[model samples]
Target: MASSAELHQRRSAAVARGVSSMIPSYVSTAGGGTMTDVDGREWIDFAAGIAVTNVGNAAPRVVEAVQAQVERFTHTCFMIAPYEQYVAVCEELAALTPGDFDKRSALFSSGAEAVENAVKIARHATGRPAVVVFDHAYHGRTNLTMALTAKVMPYKQGFGPFAGEIYRVAMSYPLRDGRSGAAAAAYAIGQIEKTVGAVNVAAVLIEPIQGEGGFVVPAEGFLPAIAAWSRAAGAVFIADEIQTGFCRTGEWFASTHEGIEPDLITTAKGIAGGLPLAAVTGRAEIMDSVHPGGLGGTYGGNPIACAAALATIETMRELDLAAAARHIESVARPRLEALAAKHPAIGEVRGRGAMLALEVVIPGEDTAAGPAPDAVLTAAVAKAAHELGLLLLTCGTYGNVIRLLPPLIISDDELDRGLSLLEQAFASSL
Candidate 1:
């Protein structure tokens, strides 16, 4: 077993020094909902590789599919050879996504790629030059997606000359703004009307539940309002479901709870169960708007990822992970909420289904009170959790929110164990 120091030194040499990790212990392998480092130490994996392994790491069916696909043929490029798995998964996405009407689906290699393509499709369909995005929204790192993304520091840092025709507005964060969902939506739309002029906008992109900005769930009526505004403006409504889709939010997609069908939906993360794959699924009309040959990359829809996606979608259905996500919420919310009640530092706890977070705000201070360093105890809580064998992440524009996105397949005992550690961390921190 490698010592933590030895592992860290080796990793620095082998992997890019720029790659960031919260844990010094390197996970060699994972299963179900937990992972072990090369040092033989185990940790409860609440991160799920930032919500990618929802079907549980190394899911049996997904493994088998990948193995089978690799043996059959790893790549012929779907745009060139075109495989059955690609079509099958698209079919599955069409069925699984919220809308019942005719839909079209396209596969890509990464979440960023899916997002960029969705924008391109929207632009081509609407013949509009402008796109509206929300502040604190995390679309991706690609050039276009970087412009689409809301946060600045790391993602947008030094990468400018971003795609033109991009505009940003604030999101509905009650803890930070003290505004209701309706107010946030109205304010955001007003920004568009006043600054960007929605008349030239091709699409309005949003995260149903903002993922990188700390699993922030907008107030009720917030998303519906935006969708309504977009419809009236003749702009495509794009829901970036890369993090919130595939039962992470207790439902198939967070937008479903609000009864909104996005014109173009970008999905990834759990879609292929830890495989490098993403997708854009939406109404046939909008998707077909793109001319043939408009979208296709060499490794866009690798056969291996497609096979894994097929297996992944099948596993989610057979195991009913959507219901499992609801079960997770039933288990986690009460325990986490109890922790919140006991700790005044926790200003708010909010989310839908298994995607939830507790905002750690300094008492008597709002989350937006000067950059979240002195106030939110997020760093302390995260440090405490890691020492006790639990992984933690602090997200949000201000870095004041700690979100939990564990695998929906985690056992009751595991959830209780993780929560117990969390409670102990809270008690000791105070």
Candidate 2:
């Protein structure tokens, strides 16, 4: 392996500046729940490639599947020459995702692609042109998705001419909104009814647990109400589970807890155990709304990615990762809440299952008021973690949320180690 200094220099010189890397550009080796730098420095990985390594890094099953697929064949393009692995992954999605109704699945290369395609299927099926989103939601970077997303600075800034026909409504961020589920739903519906006209809306897309918007779990009954509203309005309910799906949120999908059978659900990240694969699974009738040539891509469902996804689904089943994730929530949430109490700067600690975040408030830690958590404190904690051999990510529309998406495969000791580092980071920051 190359030296960290040389590797970092090469990365800065050659790699595109468009992408932002976590600290210590060189992670020497990665496996299971940890990564190391070329200098033999180890780091506990909590970010998990933004929830892509749910089964953990270099998982045995995933590696075996990918290695075997490489030996046989790589790509033939599902549009031109369909493969079994792709179908198998779809079959798994149909089986795994919650819902009693018949389902269908379509594959894509990324979360954003899957999101965009779900909207397509919804619009085609409903014969409507308008789509509704929520405030503080982070859908994707594609033109339409960027428009659908609520954040504006990083993902949206400098990106012009975002696709149109996308509308947004306020979400019940209990920390901020301080409203009941019915009130929040009514607020959102009133906005759409007054502005977009529900008849023209094809879909109402949402994150079961708002991921980039600081992992805000919407007030209870909110999702079910929205699902009912979508049906009443004759629009498809598209759950943008890209961040909350595939056993990351305790359940197989976050929406399962609310008992909402979405007309369409977009998923990615953990679905392939780190490979580039995404899927849109929902009612077969809605999925088949589009014409034969309307859906698909050159490498939408590459055989290798499909194989990896198949293995990932199987791994989730055999290992019972969903139960493991709930176990994580059971042990982690109280500890995090305790940390929040000790570190007054932490404005809030919220989320479900393994998907959670701590909002770093400026003066909120020490005093009752300060500039509402604007990126300053969270950035400090993230950097502090980096120095202490830990990788983390900062999110939120305000940029003050330290969202934790640790690999679901982390051992109990490793999880404690990571949490200790986090406590120390906050302590030092304070």
- Report the number of the highest-TM-score candidate: 2
lDDT by residue (tens digit), candidate 1, 152-176:
8788989898989999888887666
Residue lDDT tens for model 2, 242-277? 888888989899999889888888999999888999
Clashing pairs in 2: 28-36, 344-365, 345-365
lDDT of 1: 0.86
The global C-alpha lDDT for each of the candidates, from Candidate 1 onward, is: 0.86, 0.88
TM-score of 2: 0.97
TM-scores of the candidates are: 0.96, 0.97
What are the runs in model 2 whose C-alpha is more than 4 Å off? 363-371
Please give the lDDT score at residue 66 for candidate 2: 98
Residue pairs that clash (backbone atoms under 3 angstroms), model 1: 213-396, 214-396
